[model samples]
Target: MALPLVPRAIAAQPWPALLSAAFLAAFGFVTLYSAAGGSLLPWAFPHAARFGVFLGLALAISYVRPSWFREIVPYAYVGVMVLLVVVLAVGVVGGGARSWLDFGPIRLQPSELMKPILVIALAAFYSAMPPRHIQTFGAIWPAGLMIGIPVVVILLQPDLGTSLLLTFSGITTMFLAGLPLKWFIGGGVAVGGAVPAIFPFLMPHQQERILILLDPSQDPLGAGYHITQSTIAIGSGGITGQGYLNGTQSHLNFLPEQHTDFIFSAMAEEWGLLGGIAVLVGLGVLLRWGTRVAMDAKDRYEMLAAGGLTSIIFFYAAINLMMVMGLAPVVGIPLPLLSYGGSAMMTVMICLGLLMGIDRRTRRDRERRRGL
Candidate 1:
């Protein structure tokens, strides 16, 4: 009987998602290695090392009880909120955003931590709420406050990428909670009308980036340099890529932020279209598994949390890809599991871990219901 438990245990783990994550990380390691002039010391080694450490953290998180997550949601949200405030007070400035808390060698971005906690908080709130109240002001105001507070704080950090991500993730949770669609539609209309009025108030660089998006050639060597070079790198890697480690754009020092925000462009320049498809397929598998977990959740909280977590990953990957391809403005969002950054890697892994735990509970609940 004890021996038979071995295969059962192995089968219970989320191997498909794990394998997909590993594949992406390994691909990223290779890309970073190439990007660093064949040296692993700077980019490649740390990329792989952080993934290893965070993957362990994810596995540890998988073992946590779902009830514990619900219990900690409020404290976690409040704690991250405090950290965000602290960041505004004394955070280190990098990439023109005062978004990181520097503790000697360890740098923490509280905004990244807010993404999942916000999901859990919203899920817990809605799960505990009476069904009748979901359509009332009680529902909309509280959830809006939860999203708006963090967003306002982050925007003060002048980190547009993270603020948009938080807003989108929060909206995803609200939508999953069965909130009325008309509110979202109306909000979209309002935002659309407000954009024109808000344009002039934006920072000069921010306004220039938006303008550059429309006409890159007008400022190809200035504000548009990143997009122009990224486009060339991606376009040059037509089919099979320019052959790994031989990407002209990156190797020639033409690609900007090749190890972070534009890492996809660097990979594309070397690995080509086939490499891009491979990355996409890996992400596709991971996302499919995450969606299945949400669909199979036994309770409302689980479903909402899982959906929100999955959306976080989706938004990161989607935005990064679009930014590199010049389809979206460069907003400094890194590709999940593929970019060289500890903060994003930690956030994504935490999401995966939480998702796995939720998936585990869902399976166990199903088994119990069936008298397994």
Candidate 2:
């Protein structure tokens, strides 16, 4: 009897999450409008249009059956790997990274797509393996390969931001899958020890960003320009903000990447602390729904996918906000759904869609188990 109503319950749960996403996108559009000096032609319209298109694409992706997701994981992971290789051969360069593939009018970033696919593939891999193996060398090696291969490929593209995001997403999934806590502690120690050796290999600009993070005053007109200008913009906006479309820093061109990576600062300048808080609360709502779904997930696969995807969104939101405000080194991470870019919009929406897929599968599994 209760099983029959499960479908309706699942359908109703996403309204708050969906509304939050739309609202964030709308706020981003308005910021882009201001960023363009009150013109929609350049940034706002395309941003909104892409949101609509990806929202629809996400819906379609959500309908994929569990069996299909299982079957597609290997092929999807391999296909993205091939694209990563192709990118090394002839990838288009822009803004300091060669991560995009150009095919006339359509430019695709496979690394962006891989973030979520990595979640799916790893979840699928762990789902098939015996739970008992999760703590052994068997589980560690394969998962490390799944994560390490892409990290190496993208790091070579010199897109350190995306590589870190993938590593975070994959590791979060593994931890949630119940790997031994001591192993993570040991890995953390190893990673900490490796930093000294790895620091020299970092790109000059990347190293500069870290130095700026350490001392913003060191290169006020050079390396520190971004975060310095960004903090000013954020601090200028008081409790109620300077009013929408009235931010001076961005309008006067003091803020860099005002339409992309630093859009949140643009938003903070106009919307103020209140607006920032609102964005946080809104994203909190979206993530909360995902957390609930992950916690109540009906199976191991769904649990890992839902939880991993949720962690991925959290990663984007946290890193971008921190980078803009100077709490972290600038790594060129775009705010999820809010930043004016196609690649991130697609990645985040697919995450939401996949969560919806998990919800849908959870209901079906529940119904079937009850002989409904």
Candidate 3:
């Protein structure tokens, strides 16, 4: 049955998650304003416009029906594949990765959009099957095949970070869909055994990234420069931060990619640990709300969709934090709302909106069943 738009006799809707998202969005805007203060109007206006557009799109997506979402998943996945192929054919090269499709005035990165689409598609694909069917190697091969095609193509673009994210999202959705423990252990063992033989295929730069993670000092001014300077910025923040817009590391260009992939370093440098904690708290609230929605999901598809979305957000938060703290190799993953880029910011917003829509539908169903 199609769930109603609103819960019967319910006094209120979930505003905490929406409010938390709003606060984060505002925080991002302020930081962007500060980060791009000196850039020309032409350069800055596009970002600002993109932000506004994404915010509205998120709000619109929040009202969509769960059934509609399910129907759209396969199409969305196919659409992403088409765009990926298009990107490979005529992508503009930048930052050692040719992953962005150039559309003259605007550059589009399809991988960012593909993350959530892949999540939804995988969730729906798995949830439709019988649990017993998926437990064996025969049934799991199709699932692996679905994931492997895009993964291989994306990796051919040489976008290791995004390819990893895609793999992470797909595997997580599969796990949520009901994969057995033995499967995980077996997969881990396979990966462990293959790492040695497969290590030689990694690009030289990719190898350098792993080595820099081990000892950053080896190439202080080259591969390790980002980590070294980021650590300094984070440490310089001390406890309370150096204050907004006054960060020497940020303003003096000591920290690279201060507005995009490494924006957290700027936050740490300017707002210190306290500010970082604030962002974490906001993210925590959003995550908790997502989990609650997933638990209350009216069906397996919704539950899996909600869970997969939550995992994507969690992965970005955890990976970005680790990268900024120098605890993990820098993977060029943006810090959700805090980082710049239209595709990433929009994708996260869409995920939150999807969560809200799912919550709304489930609540309505509960109310209807109670005759309220």
Candidate 4:
């Protein structure tokens, strides 16, 4: 029953998942179109180009063997960590945050790279350790170091969003690796206790964001402007939306970062409740499919990596949506695939590539089992 030629490869690819992602990117491009007032130069065109480039990149990476991925995880983590140090030494300041590195042609955010790299490192670390050592401090500290190094670096970069993502991805991987619940609870308690100590070190805007999250009305026109504007935009969009290219808040300059983090509000304004639901449904499909990939993985490394990758994706979608809806602090996390930023686009596509690789591997395994 084995088939020949290009269709064989096509048959193995996850068409459903890829199609789901494509629908989201397309819908997002439409939103970006409105954000740019019907122009494509500023955001939509470049967004499309980057999506094509990164999607192709992900598809190419899908061909890499699982064993090869295992070999590269540690190296990738080390490389990203080094880039973070370089960022610290010579990073550029944007939006009052020193998180990007200027390399003449392209400004890069190395901390974004750590989202996937950190997960891979932690997954590899736990995969190598014996299960008997799971509850031991010996098991805990090394992984903590793996997580802490980049976190501290990114925090100094004062990029709370990326650091939180890295920590979440790493911790989730450890949980999947069989770490006990009590350890997680104790860690949570310790974090709560240490918040007072960490508060002083927070940047002014960071503190303002937390305060804004607590009560946006405190400075509705100043520090709380973003959330206030964002909520207004979202609420104004009734059921079917204001229609394409007709959102007043974004087009009139009332919504900040409309083409980036707050694109969702603009989108909701134009497309309405159904449109918002559509975007969430598409992402939910991707998430559910990704989780299934982890469940179907053949080994511990595959399982941990797949689940960790899914967590990274989930964290971005959940956080960005929450931030826009006034449920969480605006730490500058962008909506995956939808937000207009190369760093987030690159990170999300990499995760998709890893998922593609896992899904492809699963198919190959099944085919082999049937003696195809």
Score residue 42 of candidate 1 by CA lDDT: 91
In candidate 2, how many Å is residue 175 off? 0.2
TM-scores for all candidates: the values are 0.98, 0.95, 0.92, 0.97
Top TM-score model: 1
User: What is the C-alpha lDDT profile of model 3 across 1-372, one tens digit per residue?
Assistant: 887687743335577886777677666666665666555243245555676787678767877897787898788888989988988888887667878888887778888888888888877887788878877776578778878888888887888878777788788888888888789789989998998887788878877777798889999899999889999999998899988878888888888988887788887888889988989998999899999999999899899999989888888888888887788887788888777777777778888878878988898789889996
- The candidate maximizing lDDT is 1
lDDT of each: 0.93, 0.91, 0.81, 0.89
lDDT of candidate 1 over 160-258, digit per residue (tens): 899989999999999999988999999999999999999987778888888899978898999999999999999999999989889888988989899
What is the TM-score ranking, best to worst? 1, 4, 2, 3
| lDDT (tens digit, per residue) of candidate 2 on 1-372 | 356645875564468778999999998999899989899968999999999999998788878875587788899999999999999889999779999999897789999989989998989988999978887889888999999999999999999999999999999999998899999999999999998899999999998998889899989999999999999999999888999889999999999999999999999999999999988988898899889889889889889999999999999999999999899999989998889889899999999998987877786778889996
Better of 2 and 3 by lDDT: 2
- Per-model clash counts, in order, read 1, 0, 0, 1
Cα-based lDDT at residue 363, candidate 4? 77
RMSD of each: 1.3, 2.7, 3.7, 1.6
**Segments in model 2 whose C-alpha atoms lie over 4 Å from true places:** 1-13, 364-372
lDDT of 4 by residue, 169-256 (tens): 8998999999889999999999999999998889998999998999999999999999999999999999998888999999999999
Candidate 4: list runs displaced more than 4 Å: 1-6
